[model samples]
Every structure is written in C-alpha cells, then in structure tokens.
Target: MTARTARQRLRDDAGSAVVEFPLVAVLIILIALTLIQCALVVHTRNTLTDAAVQAAHTASLEGNEPEDGATRGAQLVHDRFGEDYAVEVDADEKGEGVVRVRITATFPLIGLIGPSGTLHVDGHAIDEETW
Candidate 1:
C-alpha cells in the first residue's frame, strides 16, 4: 500500500487522452451535424412558407389568375433557395375574393437529399378590388 506519486500518475494518464480525444471529438461532431440538419429542415420549411405567401399575394391581385400565382410561387422558391426545394406549387381560388397557395417541397436531410413532400406550407390572401 503506497502512493503512486505525481510522475507515475501523469505517465498512466498520458495515452488516455489520445484514446478519449477521438471518441469525444466524434460525438461532438455528430451532435453538430445533427443540429445543422435540423436547422436546414427548418429553414427550408420557413422559406417555403414565404414563397407561398408571396404567391398568394401575387395571385390575389385584382385581375391576376390562379395559374399566375402558382407560377410566381414556384419561381420564388427556385430563385430564393434553389430548384431542389420547389417540388410543387399550387394556387387556387378559395372563394370569390380569397386566394390560397400551397407549396410542397423536399428539405435537405444531408446535401440536398430528403423525403419528398415532407415540407408543406400554405398561404392565403384576399384579392384586391376589381370593381
């Protein structure tokens, strides 16, 4: 029964950090990557919502057609982010003066590959005065 002394303890722990460093570093990297993926999904969804809203506004104009709104929404999604996110853009008249825009797109799981139609957003607006 005796103390190992500072020098012996230091030697024993010398290679321990080398082994632990990789394990710790890998875990940290994994966490960081997961966080980035989540952020990407959120950003894609939010951007889709924005595109839908823009389309709704454009389509709800006094004399704009629903098709025009759909086109505008698709273009906005492509221009703002990229073509990958804009899978489908649909616009229709909800009523006499209301326009609805729906956007369906795929968000990035990693490097632009994800489940299709996973992210969907809808927007509505009132048409302007036509009289």
Candidate 2:
C-alpha cells in the first residue's frame, strides 16, 4: 500500500474509538447500575434474615414470652436497617420446643420502588428448657 493510503487508514481507525465510546459507555453504565441493584437486594435479604435469627434466639430462651421475639426482631430491623424496613414481625410456636420468627418488609430495588408484600424472611430455633 502507498504511504498516503496507510496514513489515511490510521486516521480513520483512530477516530473510531471516539465514536464508539458513547455507545459503549451507556451499556457499561447500565450494567454497573444493574449490579448495584442486585447487591442491594441481597444485602436487604441478609439483613432481614439476621434480624429474624436474633429475634428467634431471644424468644427461644426459657423465660421470654413469644411476643417478645417479634418485638425484639422489629427493633433490630429498625436499628440496623431503618424504620421503613421494619414493616411486620411475627413469632410463632411451632411445636413443643420450637419457635419461629418471620419478618416481612419492602424489598428495595430502585430507591423505594420495589414490590410490596413479597419479601419474607424466617428464623427458627429450639426453645430452652429450665429447671
């Protein structure tokens, strides 16, 4: 190839990246935002599970009332996450020596625009026996 033709080819390819950046940039930003939203959903679920476990442990003690577990779990959710996330807390006695705690809250996807009444987390523990 001639030197002039080679130089022209180089110049055309060099500006290709400039034209491509805007298109690729939008796709990259979209992927990043999707990943962040997934992380948020996982974090919220883990937090809710932790709160339920703590409440179940508290209620399974020898002397604590079942309702206390729900209250404690609600407080934990409120303190750790926020009042908006501490939506509903329930404690149930499953059998002779088992207690279960369930927590329901709004799952955050995009800054408070998530599905309602769908997210639920539960914790179970055996009750302690006292003399």
Candidate 3:
C-alpha cells in the first residue's frame, strides 16, 4: 500500500480505542456486578440455611421448645446480617421424632435488597427426647 493510504487508514483507526474502551468496559463491569450479586445471594442463602440448622439442633436438646429454636435462628441471622435482612423463622415437630426449622426471607436481588418471601430454607434434626 502507498504510504499516504497507510497514513489515511491509521487516521481512520485513531481514537477507536477511546470509543471502544467505554463500551467494553461497561460490558465487563456489568458482568462483574452480576457475578458479585450471584455470590452475595449464594452467601446469604448458605448463611440462612446454617442458621436454621443450628436452631433446629438447639431446639432438639430435650427440654428446648420449637419457639426457642426459631428465636435462636432469628438471632443468628440478625447478628450476622444485621437488620437489613427481613428473616422469619419457624420450628415445629415434623413427625417421627424429628424437628424441623423453616426460614423464610427476602432473597438479595440488588445490593442486599430484594422482594420479600423470595427465599426459603429448611433444617431438620432429631429430637433428643427420642434418643
């Protein structure tokens, strides 16, 4: 190619990086945000599940009541996540000497806030009285 033609092509391509950068950067940023949100949601779910299980275990300790388990679970959630998460815990006997704890809460959709009643988790333990 002629030197003039090459220079003209270079001119046409000049500043393309500046224009393309924001576009690609925006896409990358969006992907990163989505991944981060997914991680947060997973973490929240795991935390809730852990709390429920612990509550069930506590309540299964012979003399403890279902309400006690529910309260413990709620406190655990509140302590870890603070009051930002609207969590509800319920515990009851689930037949055959088993205790079940159920946790319902809002699933984080955006930055730890989301529609209510979007998450549900259950934990079960054998009642110590049966042992």
lDDT of 1: 0.83
Instruction: Report the lDDT tens digits of candidate 1 across residue range 8-113.
Output: 7867766888899999999999999899888877888888898899999999888789899999999998898866444788888865778899998876668456
Per-candidate clash tally: 0, 0, 0
Worst 10 residues of 2 by lDDT: 109-118
Per-residue lDDT value at 78 in model 2: 94
- List where candidate 1 sits over 4 angstroms from the true fold: 1-11, 84-86, 114-117
- Cα lDDT of candidate 3 equals 0.90
Cα lDDT of candidate 2 equals 0.85
Where model 2 places Cα greater than 4 Å from the true spot, the runs are: 1-14, 111-117
Please provide TM-scores, in order, for all candidate models, with all chains considered together.
0.80, 0.81, 0.86
lDDT ranking of the models: 3, 2, 1
In order, the Cα lDDT scores of the candidates are 0.83, 0.85, 0.90
lDDT tens per residue, model 3, 1-131: 69999889887877899999999999999999999988988998899999999999999998999999999999999999888667889999977999999999887678655553379999999999998
How far does residue 56 in candidate 2 sit from its true spot (Å)? Answer: 0.2
